[model samples]
Target: MQEALRLNKPVLAICRGMQILNVAMGGTLIQDILELWGGSIKHFREELPEHMPAHTVDLCGEKITEIMGKEKIDVNSFHHQAIDRLGTGLLCTGISPDKIIETVEAPGYFWVIGVQWHPELMFNYFEEQHNLFKSLVTKCLENMP
Candidate 1:
């Protein structure tokens, strides 16, 4: 992820990938969401259906709101760790109802974005989620050598 960011490559990081992206860029993680940042929201919901909407993330970043084409989105959560201090050059784009970071983007990069939720599992059910994949592919194509 650090290399990709250095090379200005298009990236669509999800779940742990998002954590990796943040760490690669000098950001920190909460280690354990429930253990440290306990709240009404369940950050890790393995018992629930994988495709079910676990919670909603409010889009705040202008770039993300534009990419998602909405102010809010429903997402499934299945991770205990999340981005705490944002990485250098990265911006918080989305957040859960309980204020957990759900999505981030590196505005300096060509198309580097990360999401805490598993969009690959939710794309089939949500058109917006599917569009996330499409956007990455499109960015890759547009920047192809």
Candidate 2:
């Protein structure tokens, strides 16, 4: 990650990958949600009713909002870990209302975005999620020079 950052590469980190990015850059994690939230609130409802929406995330008015062009996005969650202390040069770009860090980015670098939710799972369910990948690819291509 540091190598990619040094090279000004575009990055799209998902779930644990996002957490790893944060830690690699000096961030802290919430560790365990069940203990923090004091309930059996399952982040991943893999067996839940199909009609139920998994979770929602609020996009901060910074990098993510600029890229996604939205204030809020409903996303699927399947992680127990989250960012607590933000890393150096990193800013929160999205969050769960419960204060869980859903996304972060270092605008100092080129096209670096991280999300706690799994956008890959929502690619077909939401066009915006697909657009996220398209945008990342475009940025990566543009930054290849």
Q: Write the per-residue lDDT of candidate 1 for residues 10-80, one digit (tens) a residue.
A: 99999999999999999999999889999689989999888889999999887678878999899999999
What is the Å distance of residue 27 in model 2 from its true position? 0.8
Model 2 lDDT tens row, 31-79: 8887776443467666854334477788974767876778888888787
**Candidate 2 vs. truth: CA RMSD?**
2.2
- Evaluated against the true structure, the overall lDDT of model 2 is 0.80
> Each candidate's lDDT (Cα)?
0.91, 0.80
What's model 1's TM-score?
Answer: 0.97
List the pairs of residues colliding in candidate 1.
none
- Model 2: runs farther than 4 Å from truth? 48-52
